[model samples]
Structure formats: structure tokens, C-alpha cells
Target: MADLLTPGLILAAAATFLFAGLVKGVTGMGLPTFAMAVLGSLVSPAAAAALLIVPSFVTNLWQLLAGPAFAGLARRLWPMMAGIVAGTFAGASLLASGDTGASTAALGATLVAYAAWSLLGRQPRAPARLERWASPIVGLATGLVTGATGVFVVPAVPYLQALDLEKDDLVQALGLSFTVSTLALAGALAVRGAYQVGDLAVSTFAVLPALAGMWLGQEIRRRVSPAAFRRWFLVGLLLLGAEMLLRPLF
Candidate 1:
């Protein structure tokens, strides 16, 4: 594992996690997307995904323990979780077979599109009749991306924001969604034999930076205004997406 931690890579991972965690702390989402988009440039996609597993797990655990809304969220979101499980399996299988370029491209494009729409104030409108059916689609898309790239919030975040749930409930739902999807992805990866002993070891090592970032983010979130946070978060997402798109080209 020491061999895996070159000084430069450690610094890069620390910076990426710090930024990613800051976004999540301020806006209640986007950690994986921020971290993976940055770290994927430095590491293999699979490794990047694996590195996120423990940090996401820890954060979700904290969320669950933080309040009572998890039960309500579970009741309302079971269908979405089901879809995520199925789609994650499919996505993980694809990754395990050693072809992830297409998925990476899709993730990059989706992030860019999402950031643009968000900046333009084009949030998804609440659908009266279609509300019941939307969760499955969001779940499927999120899970597929989660499995492919270890970042699954893109589909669900916009809709979650649009629904205007109470802030506590919203946080609960986001945490539950990420938790379930992460578990599903890990299961899928296991089924596909994507995990190696060394990879697991390296992943454990990655947790330190992630936790540090989370702590730092908590401090920063206290000082930032919501509007300011949103502006910076969108800028970060756009730059992250642009970086992803340009990486393959170069």
C-alpha cells in the first residue's frame, strides 16, 4: 500500500476529497461525482470507484444515525432502491469485463448537462401524474452510473431538490439513496470478481483523506452562505465535467 501512496498522488487525492466533501457538506450531495471526476484522471476508473466505497459508507452511516427520517425515506423509496440494485449489477458487470470508457463518457456528459441545467435554473418541474413513476427511472439511471463510475447522485439530486421535501427529510433521503446504491454496487462488484486483495488494501488507505476532507468540509460549511456555496459548487461541477471530457481526448 505504501507503494501506491506516492507523495503526489496522496496530495491529489487529499485535494480532491477536500473539495468533494466541501460540496457535499454545503449542498448535501455531489461528493462522489466531485472526487471521482478528479481522481479518475489520476487512477484507474475501477480504483477510483473502489476508493469511494468506504467514505460514502461512513457518511451515510452518519446520516442514518443523525435522525429519524430514514424510516420515512425507506418507505417512500423502496422502489427506487430496487431499481438501483438491478441497474448497479448490470453496470458493475460491464466494468468488471474491463470496458468502462463509454460509461465514463456518459458520466462526464451527464454531469455537464446537469450543471448547465442547474445554472440555467432549469430544474425538473414537479409532475403530478408522473411522480409515482419517476423514482424507478431515477434509480435505474443513478444505479447504472454508480456501478459504472461510483457516482450515482446525478439522477436523484435534481428530482430530490425539485420535490421540496423538508431539509431534514431531503438529507435523510440523499443519505439513504447513496447508502443503498453503494451497497448494491459493492455486491455487484463482488459478483463480478472486480475486487482484488491489493485493491481492497489501497481502498482502505484512501479512507484517511476522505475522512479528513469531511471534517474540513464541516468547518467550511459553517462559514459559507447557501447562495455562495451553490455558485462555487456549480463551477466545480462544470470544471470537473470539462476535465473528464478533455482527458480522453488528450
Candidate 2:
């Protein structure tokens, strides 16, 4: 635990969380994805996962509850949430077994894959008719990935984005999904003894910088187009993913 508190690591953590909050503040998503990628660069993937708990939970919860659409969104998205819960438990088992290198590598590859999709892939629309079957399927897949790699993107983010929701609803949906993923992940870490009181305390402290960033980012969002920010964000994800993928090679 003491090892995680070194000045360099603390600085790294603060900077990473702040950036994560900013991205989420502006785009309504990407907090965990960005934070984990950057933190995974400086720390073990497992540690990065632990560090994410508090900020992810609080920020996402705020996102989830701040809007008036929670009930409607929950009813519409319950199937996916259910799948996410089940998949997370299954994925966490693998993480708890100490498969650090493979998990982190997988996380990196997953990020790269998603970034590629965001950058170059066509935005496939979710047909209104097929949403019933598709929602849970996407949720399950996302949960599995979250459990295995501590990431909650992939098909989920793109899937939700494709729904063509109102901007506020879309943001709430992201918050809802992220909140579920974070809690499910916390459960997994707890079961495996990877998460502890001390870690929670530290993660809680980390939330301050993240929130500060979010506040600043919200101000920025008022001025900049999200489309532009997302383009650059995807490019960054690509580079980070490549690094993670190739780290074990060299």
C-alpha cells in the first residue's frame, strides 16, 4: 500500500484522474477508460483498477442521479444491466487469479480496438425493433470485458451511442452504465481480496482532483464541440493501447 503513495505515483494518479474527470465532464463518458489507460501505464493494471473505484463510483453516481431520467432509463436499460452484473462476476474470477500481464495487455488491445472503431468504423444504427435482444447482449459483453480488463467500453459505449438518444438522456445512460460497471467491479475486487479499506480510502481521496477536473471540463464543454474532443481522445486511446499491447513484447 505504501508503495502506491510515492510522490511520483501520487502525481501520476492525480493527473490521470483529473484528465479522466475532464473528459467525462465534457463528453459524458470515458472517465474509467482514460484513467485506467493512463494509470495502467504507470502502475500495475490491478492497482489501476483499485485506484479507479471511488472516483468512478462517485462521479458516475452523480451522473446517474443528477438527471431526471433515471427511472425511464433504468426500465429501458435493465436487461443490459442484468447481463453486466452476471458477466462481471465471471470476469472477476479471472482477475483475482493474478493474471496481471495478460489482463493489462488485453485492456490495451481492447482500448485500441474500440478507438479504431470510433475513429474509422461506421456508426451502425441500432434498429428500433432489434433493441430488445441487442441491449442485454451488448451489456453482457461489456460486463465481461469490464470484469476481465477493468474497462467498460467496447460494444457498450458504441452501442449506447448508436441509439440516437437526446444528449441529456445519452449522458444519463452513460452514467447509469458506468455506475453499474463500477459497482460490479468493486464486488469482484472485494471477492478476490484485491480491494481493501485502505485502497478505498486512497481512491476516495483521489476523487477530489477528478471532480475538480470535471468542473473545469464542464466549463470547457460549454465552449468546444464534443465531436472534436472525441476525435483527439480516440487518437490518444490508440497510442495508449498500442503501448499496452507491445509492453510485454519488449
Candidate 3:
């Protein structure tokens, strides 16, 4: 892993984070997923995960705070958040074990499933009664996936969507969920001894570009059609996921 951090690679990573941030700015999500997907192709999934900590955390924290109903949302989502932290801790070693091949495959598979779900416009419903039991389960599953593959938008996002939240509420919920996932993943990396000092510095510096791109993306969102951009984004994720899924064969 030490040998992996060349200057050129670091530069590329900064640029990637910028683009990922842009995507999130436009859509309110996808920063982690897009960055991890592209960076996993350039670096190991574990390394990519390390790079994401600061930028993802900052952006998501902002998103989480921008909503009007923070206290209520947190109260409602506590069970799920706790489950995510516990499950992430449990499965952390899978990602930190230097098993790049398996981690990449897992990530690719996750991206594919998410993209397909979005593209197909499938919105599974979960009643209010189901939230008590379902939230924790979804969080645990999402955390396990995050710990394994450095991506955290599987069953959790879909499950949240299933609850039929209003548009503003849904965006804030995603921010809250992702913020928790980022923190948990960071903890997992620390416990696994995968978060190196130098990587932390780079991750911090990368935040600048990420924020810049996000600002630009917000401007574009005001002018461009977000629905069209999201369509293209999903398509790109689908293709990227397919490539990674077949990477071992090639």
C-alpha cells in the first residue's frame, strides 16, 4: 500500500473526488459511491476507502445539517444508525485484509445492483409499522456491505426510499445515513490499522477540490436538467460496475 501512493496517483485521486463531489452536489448523493468506484479501479478498495473519509464526511455533514428536521430525523433513525456502526465493526476486517480482488468484486456488484434499481424505477414500499423492525436490519446489511466493499448505498438507500419520505426529507435522510456510514467506515479503517498518516493528509487536501466541484455542480443544477443528468449518471455507474465485475476475467 505504501508503494501505491505515487504523486501522480494522488493527483488523479483529487480530480476524481472533485467529480464525485459534483455528482453529489447535483443529486445529493453518489459522492462516496462514484469516488469509490473510480478510485477502486485506480487503487485498491481499501485505499480508496481511506481517501474518501474527510471529503465524504464534510459534504455529507453539510447535507445532514441543511435539512429543517434534524432532531426528529435523528430520533427516528437512531436504531438504524446503531446497527450500521455495529455491523461495520463486525465486517471491517474483510476490507482491511488486503484482499483487493474480493473487495473490488463486491463493490462492483453493489454498484450494479444500485444502478439497476434506480434505472428500473423500482420503489419498494415499507409501511410505518415496518420501520421499527426494518430499519435496524437495513442498517446492519448496509454496514456489512460498507465494511466489505467501501460502498454503503445498498439495501439502506432503497429501504429509506421505500418509506415514502417527501423529497426534501428523503434527501436529508440520505445525508444522515451516509454521514453515519462514513464515520463507521472511518472507525473500521482505524481499527484495522489501514488509515495511514500520509493518507489522512491527502484525504484532507482532497476536500478542497471536492468542495469546489460541488459548488460548480450546484450552479449547473440550477441551469441543467437534474433528471437528465441523473439518468446519465446511473448509466455511467452501470457501465463502470460492469467493467469492474468483469475485471478479474480480463
Cα TM-score per model: 0.87, 0.95, 0.96
Output the lDDT of residue 91, model 3.
76
Query: Residue 74 of candidate 2: its Cα lDDT?
Result: 96
lDDT of 2 by residue, 1-250 (tens): 4356798889889999999999988877888999989988777777889999999999999988888799999999999999898888888766666776788788899899999998999878898899999998999899888888889987788999899988889888988999999999999889888888899888998899999989988999999998899899989999999999988888
Best first by TM-score, ranked? 3, 2, 1
| Per-residue C-alpha lDDT of model 1 across residues 154-226, encoded as one tens digit per residue | 6777777777788888788878888888788778877777765565666666666666767777787788786
Task: List the candidate 1 regions with Cα displacement exceeding 4 Å.
Answer: 1-5
* TM-score of candidate 2 on Cα atoms, chains taken together: 0.95
Give the per-residue Cα lDDT of candidate 2 at 109.
91
Whole-model alpha-carbon lDDT for candidate 2: 0.88
Candidate 3: deviation at residue 13, Å?
0.9
TM-score: the better of candidates 2 and 3: 3
What are the per-model C-alpha RMSD values against the true structure?
2.4, 1.5, 1.2
- In candidate 2, position 164 carries an lDDT of 91
> Global lDDT of each model?
0.73, 0.88, 0.89
